[model samples]
Target: MSARPRPLLLGAGTAIAVAVTLSGCTQKASSEDGAVSVTASDSVCEVSKTELPAGHVSLALENKGSKITEVYVLFPDGRIAAERENIGPGTKATLVTELKAGDYEIACKPGMKGDGIRQKIALTGKDTAAERSPESDAAVAAYRSYVLAQAEQTLPRAQAFADAVKAGDIEKAKGLYASSRIGWERTEPVAESFGDIDPKVDVREDGLEDGQDPTTDWTGWHRLEKALWQDKKIGDRERELADQLMTDLNAWVKKVGTAEITPTSMANGAKSLLDEVARNKVTGEEERYSHTDLIDFKANLEGARRSYDLLKPIAQKNDPALAKELGQRFASLTGQLDAYRTDDGADEDSYTYTSYDMVSEAERKELSDGVNALAEPLSKLAAAVAK
Candidate 1:
């Protein structure tokens, strides 16, 4: 048996990799009016003014906390409107959000995990941001619609996979695993928002503190993957893990429907998806037991492309040059991936890919170069759309 590679996530306690905050693009608060000042420290979340006239609001957040922290503007029911994650101590970042007249909350996550400390905020006057930028609003709606649709498709398939495992049908369960993961991978950030559930549903084996100690530390999708493929049996433990995964995924599907999708989030999500490809999928680290890393690679690329498509109109309207470059780069990357595709000759998304281990070194190098090329233009997308 081949030695399993470490997974992208580590440990049950590890936080989901959130969006890389757009700190570099922030402007000085002194020059920007209607900017709300927020100061975060070890113990509390402080907002300069809790009451404000509604419209577009900029949050100038400074982290004085010792640990890396995050701040979020949440809807009353905990959907994220805007957030800045991974703000190191003594650093500052800005998040601009279009808020309407509604009840809201500001949550400061001091250590970047758990339910955050919250404070109520009041918004007066009508929401002018929606009226001001109809394009942006439409983009958000389109992305949300896409996510909800993916969720609907994912739920039944995921449940079937779980059911197969529970019934001790190892081969059937194995076949269903890759396809069932598409929706979850595509809408990862929204799933990550439900911190408690993400780990249960998607945490990989490397995420365990004791990878060798299956009894004590192992659970979730990769746990079942290892059992079916490596141990070659389905038993009591497999059944339990499958049941838990389905439960978490079911709750995730319902919960993410309420998630707020914004242009900034769309941009950040695209970058994060490619980041997944570069950091883990390209390295053949994601599906070590199954040797299906290429499947994840394709899924991450599709996820990134979907986000780019959602924001393309706004991005083009904002910066035509950058937008054109991005489109071309995406095409280049797609063509490169097209080379490795199996003769099944189905659509790009449904095309079956060869195992990563089967590809020659030179082919892998070309694929890696293509990913790097896409990353260059991909990184600029968030700031371009935000501007």
Candidate 2:
């Protein structure tokens, strides 16, 4: 991929590629009395700058342009307070809310959602900069502790659910599985630790066969939560099936174990990635997700390796096989990365963003499909074994 964006003309089947964040904007803020106003346009959401007076100050959005606009108040912590949609131009709407001093983004268009535009509104009274307690290392530690707890609790529930379904205790298994889903949801943020099959039913991915095909549904130890809990009536078949499911699920969880993360590790990893994207140069190994891309991929692979390793101590571990498959897929990816090497034998140090155009579509698909296949088995493993 070249450093500069080349605009294609006519029908060469060409398209210009660039990061969407580099968009330009120029709009001014207007303020009158306690209310703030601005000329809204598609290009930018303009508003006043001197922070809102320290107190409960109401914001009135007056759209003077011709087109419809959406107004939103984004707090410093990335929480959206109030939003108005399809407000016609030459119309005024009031956003009755209070703002605390920090930083805020006021927007008139969803297109400019991440655009860091500020409508400095300051609320008076409390000098407290925090509505919630400040983030501490202890808090993060507690979160990790909570993840392990949730994982342990949910994995058993999931196993019980599977067993109940297999044992033909449909009602018992379904109720247990539904409760397990709540357990699984709590652990989702730390899911990368165990290769699938660890016995924790990942609510996001695995599901019981729910379509018109009855035989295909619940083929594996896991079944859809809704099917097990809400849809199916309690019966002996359900109990028997659930019991069978638990046998598989428990075995899997015992094989793979808890997810782990080092303190200050993830943040440092993110910074390394942003440093690369900041450079935005795409080439060589950097052409793909090498550098920042590679680091992220590497971290993910490390996570995969850990999960795979966790499964190593047990018999019938599905993760090792998946890990080996992933290794091969990664090897296949090396060839596609070769396209980025220039004739000069020098890889650009400024590699910030990788453009996929450097490789062929067939190659991209091949790698993507490989990753997907690897993930599918992992998902099963996690559902079957999560502990």
Candidate 3:
């Protein structure tokens, strides 16, 4: 089974086009209000403008492609500044983020695969420092600290899981698998911003790109997952991949400090986490072998909550009704998810849930509906906070 669209933070230089266009009378990319228009189709990705003043920028994405598409605003180094994924054919969505004066690229993936078509863009003007408030700055700082803490905690757990896999202890590795991913699930958008790390540490078998050799190119948690669950045997390749996974994770921990995080990014990331749940976890595609989708779903919810809580003050002050609606929606979704808990334990850190495969279609629909209800209000968060 092919995996659903997975989030990517970086791409290889060979796969991306980095040419910048300084002068063109091509389609108008930016509106008078400063939102850049992006038109994505099977063969082309057109932006309204190639250069603009730096600060808060919005990309209004229209997916003219036949397949679902995703768009990314990337730093010159390939780090993701902001992205909007899972825009269905003929549908439209918006992505908002903060950018400083520098060179960047706007990339569109028609089928949400490969490195995508790239258009180099330049952001010229003053820094965004003058436009920000102390509260918004604090929210960004707090979210950064939270992301760093999750990364710090993730390493030891992931190390333990890796050690079990390398030792060929199938039962121990299975035991540690879902718990090990909690930190990563909670802050996935941040990990993905690094571009090179997420695919190495988390990509599934079906998520492999064209020309990617499974025997050699496929290396990550899912590779080891198939070994333990489907093959029911450990081999040299699995052990080697286990070690590689740890190396990639350690690099991710080190890179978190340099991620481009902002108030709008935090709000946007919170919504994206919900999209992850709706698109993959709810469909039981993420953990096909282990049936651990619920664990990931819970972690994604927690991560979104963390971002929302950090920005709640600013959002509340800006739009009280939207803030209240978001609060209720989050709580409602939390309640729905809590019913799946397998343990009566009060410790959230030690909680578990029924395997995703065991969940009925009706239950999944209810969960999906809850996510949609929350997502509608959550989508307004970036604009609310940016005010």
Which candidate leads the pack in lDDT?
Answer: 3
Query: What TM-score would each prediction reach against the true structure?
Result: 0.72, 0.27, 0.93
Tens digit of per-residue lDDT, candidate 3, span 152-190: 998899999999998989999999998889999999999
- Which candidate comes out best when scored by TM-score? 3
**Model 2 bad stretches (over 4 Å):** 1-31, 65-67, 110-387
lDDT of 3 at 131: 74
For model 1, residues 1-387, the per-residue Cα lDDT tens digits are 012221122233433222212222121233255578777777777676667777656778888889877777766545556666667899987666566787666777776555566666778897565563677788888889888888888888888899999999999998888877888777776666544565566666654433357575566788888888889999898898888888878888787777756677777667667766776777777787887777777777888898898788888998999889889988889888867777576654345778788988788788889898988677667667766
- Backbone clashes for every candidate come to 2, 60, 5
Which candidate, 1 or 2, has the higher TM-score? 1
- Tell me the whole-model lDDT of each prediction, alpha carbons only: 0.71, 0.39, 0.84
Model 3 bad stretches (over 4 Å): 1-26, 32-34
Models ranked on TM-score: 3, 1, 2
Model 1 misplacement above 4 A: 1-128, 208-217, 347-349, 360-362
Q: Name the 10 consecutive residues with the lowest summed lDDT in model 3.
A: 17-26
Pairs clashing within candidate 1: 10-207, 11-207
Query: What lDDT does model 3 reach?
Result: 0.84
lDDT of 2 by residue, 137-184 (tens): 343355455445554665565676666655666657544543444333
